[model samples]
Target: MTDPYERLRAEAEAGRVEEVVVAVPDLQGRLMGSRLSVPYFLEEAARGGFGACVYLLATDVEMDTGPGYAIDAWDSGFGDFVLRPDPATLRTVLPWDEGTALVLADAVWPAGPGGGHGPGHGPEHGPEPVAVAPRHVLRTQLDRLAARGLTAYAGTELEFLLFTASYREAWERRYTGLRPAARYNTDYSLQGLEEVEPVARRIRRAMTRAGLRMETARGECHPGQYEIVFRYDEAMATCDNHVLFKDGAKRIAAAEGASLTFMPKFDEGEGNSCHVHLSLRGTDGTPVLADPSAGDGMSELMRHFIAGQLACLPDLALLMAPNVNSYKRLQPGAFAPTGIAWGRDNRTCPIRVVGSGPSLRIEHRVPGGDANPYLAVAAAVAAGLYGIDNRLPLPPEHTANALADPAVPRLPATLTEALHRWEGSGIAAELFGKETVAHYARAARAELSAFERAVTDWERVRGFERL
Candidate 1:
């Protein structure tokens, strides 16, 4: 049983692979990239791929230059940082029409002779600097889980809405009298899915061709909404595939004249959630979280992990719900959980414990589909690791309504509160680093400032004559 790297190298050498596209997910969950030749990537750049500026991760959704990042500024000269390719993530891009392959890598301090290529776009010069990248931070958390003799298995349920054209087209038309890819709210309606079967089939086929094990695909709660479930894999791979999955889905959808949106709440009473299912396995591959005799087949370790997550849920809110629009889904009875509670098969609870065999795991219902998968997984894994390290006690299970039960803590009510909590949180700072945390907080504040300066149509409609 050779490792994934060896297999991928063989595949690449055999001419089974074409170009290698290097990518990292940006703030708005969009994959940003610069493609490199396979030979260059493998020989010289593979160990340390090309270096891009650190500001790539510092900006907002619009890529606007932001303020308050202590590391980068107009004066300090935002320098080039390294992107170290993770060969484990290499895969052939079967979904694309062209001959190409893809891999996900970590942005790190380039490790090469004579240090990293210094500052500029030129090659072969300078010394490596000390810096923390998002993926590297996540790898540290994953290493912590491994140290505890625990391996994590996880899955993400992707929910997204489909419209006929680009967002610009829809917005310019006032989103009125728009045509959905599907006709009605087709929750489990196979007939509706059939109407979009060409695109849906491509999504499944492409994902499978890319080596992702997809379980099911069906229509979701909203008119154009759809959901796809992937078979569980190792925690890190789960998040890696998620980024590729979204990119693949969107590309396939666009070819078929549809646009995929993972926005939390696209419209009033219409939202999509990315539910993550997670479990821990012992060294022998048996689930450590499953005990038939325990509460809901959940072991003490599982309880404590959930307890740690709940205790720090507020601080993790920013990671799970990154954008300003994401806060809209926090309202009750909207199928998105507002309170932090776990129960056996309870959809209302923030965490739902499911399965009975080795698959017994938790489904965290808090994250929106738009969350940056790297950051989201890192935050969750960090909290769970804290639980295992401290031997934290799990709270009593909540069988009743979590929202009505005042005992279970609720998520941050608004983006403002969430941002404040993220800024002040010691756990977040420790996990994400001062620079990363500060950059995101500053970006959020910039967005808030922009929103304050604008006057919306609603304001004029409600107060134009009265005020």
Candidate 2:
């Protein structure tokens, strides 16, 4: 792992790099920003950071304003938010514009008008970093883990469905009547993957060049859907790579004259998922979850962490599954977890404990394909840390099918219920910071409200014809 700035500088000096991009993940996990000529990026943005609209953090997926957010709005008049470049995230984005590299940013706001703002900029003192910003929220949780002499490591396995229609065509069709990349269920089917091999291979190569230790890329159970796997890394590193992986895949799809969606469900088909695998380590690099003496191969520390995640699963459900369609994928028979329980490598349980030795870890299967990588990790880590802090006890290992288990705790079934649970969660408030919780909760509720206000085809089909 060479310093990204140094690598970018070297590549630029060699005349191999032409463009540099400064991007920040918005509330919807979409990277929003502009491209800079390598010279300007190297001269100014690479060091001092760049200015972007404050609305990027305050808006919804459509970039429309939502009510009750504590941040910028029409009343306040949109202001500029600074993008502090993170040198660590600089990487090449291949198959994109020739000779292009990308870097993510930390959003910093002005302390006062023209008084110098954006972190690491201005006279001795300058702009303050927005603590509640998505990246900042993840950093806060990781920093907390480090301070306790523990290392948090995780990986995100993203599943998405590819469409034969190009992005423009998909848009023109309003995303309807599009065909899957493949016509049949292609779970582990190499021949089936051949249909999307070119697209999948291109995405995999880009991610590898950008530095994701890719584990596998294969078709899952559903048609048109595929999964890309990655080796686990430290929390921040894993998430940064996940964001790039996601962005790169979408870019590749658009370039290849195809389209896709990471949304939980695509109409009457199987759902996508962004399953996360996680574990903690000691400063000495020991697997903290492993205990040879324990029957289930989990130490007391690991049990407490699981207990914590279970306790907070409902509280953080909104962060995990943020959209209205998200809940549609959480129902039983989808192979998605509907109850809060742990099992030994069990796919039916919300928490799956796997590996008995050094690789011991917990897989949180609660999130849908649409979860924000940074916020999702933040929610899990914060809950695990809280569990450690409070010594929460693990519930009984759900040896039976969690879907049929009556005594097991059930997670929120709808976006509205999840929001209510999130609103009442003190752990979420404490872990994500009160301001971050309120802002995100407000945004989540707004999304729910908007969906509620709309009239859907289901309603029309049920009521329009007869009554």
Best by TM-score: 2
lDDT of 1 by residue, 1-467 (tens): 65545554666788776577877666655667777877777776676577777677667666766557544535436665566667788786556546677777666554444233323222453333323345655667777788878787788988988887765676677665567778887988877765567778888888898899989989887888888899888878888888888888888887776677888887785688988888889867878987888746678788888887887889878878877777888787677888888788898898888888787788888888887776677788888877766788887778898877777678997889999999999988876678778877887786777778878767987999998
Q: Could you tell me which 10 consecutive residues in candidate 2 have the lowest summed lDDT? A: 113-122
Q: How accurate is candidate 1 locally (lDDT)?
A: 0.76
Q: For each candidate, what is the lDDT?
A: 0.76, 0.84
lDDT of 2: 0.84
Q: Best-fitting candidate, measured by lDDT?
A: 2
TM-score for each model: 0.89, 0.95
lDDT tens digits, residues 95-165, model 2?
Answer: 55678888899998755545332335555556777776788888888889889888989988899999888
- Model 1 spans > 4 angstroms off: 1-17, 111-132, 166-168, 171-177, 293-296, 430-433, 463-467
